[model samples]
Target: MTSADRLWPFLCPSHPDHDDQSLNPVAADAPSLVNLECSRVLVCVAENDLLKERGWLYYQELGRRGWIGVVEIQETQGEDHGFHLYALGNEKAQDMIKRLAAFFNREMPPLL
Candidate 1:
């Protein structure tokens, strides 16, 4: 973890004051993570993002959990956080959008 993550000054100033178990859903005491009303989960992590490790941790923990749902992670190599937004028409961004549409409901219908 970096200094900003540890201190949480920029993102969430009061984060350090909060309990770690509650702050991090992947914490050991966070059984509530398995109880969210979602039926499926798709964690998208960009390879060079600062939060990539956290994304992987969430994906891994949720998979091992006995929750009655599906969980998986997709890593975009050589990309940083919010790359999809910046490169809206890029191949990986379009692929991620398709995956997200499927995750929310059905596969996106053909554009034609």
Candidate 2:
């Protein structure tokens, strides 16, 4: 088996080189800032050497407007972007899922 096949089974279970394309148009616009007014917003960002450099700026912009409801940063020390997806059995991904679940539960409780 190839290394990517062995490492990231979910990303490309059958073909390691397959391209999966998905986009969020709303998240790509400047006016997308209004979307953060929700009761809670979970931002899962990795501490990639390059990506992490933008974290502070993102945090500052989001925090300054007081529009964000919740912010979570995953610090993957010595790791690069897309580590969670690459590391199939990564603890950070699991933890992030759990945290997101909790946040949704708290923010959007079930109807009585």
lDDT of each: 0.71, 0.51
Candidate 2: regions farther than 4 A off: 1-29, 32-35, 66-68, 108-112
Reference-based TM-score, model 2: 0.50
Distance (Å) between predicted and true CA of 54, model 1? 0.5
Which 10-residue span in candidate 1 carries the lowest summed lDDT? 14-23
Q: How many steric clashes does model 1 contain? A: 0
Best by lDDT: 1
lDDT of candidate 2 over 31-78, digit per residue (tens): 544355455445556655443544554555565655545555556565
lDDT of 1 at 96: 83
**Cα TM-score per model:** 0.75, 0.50
Q: List the residue pairs that clash in candidate 2.
A: none
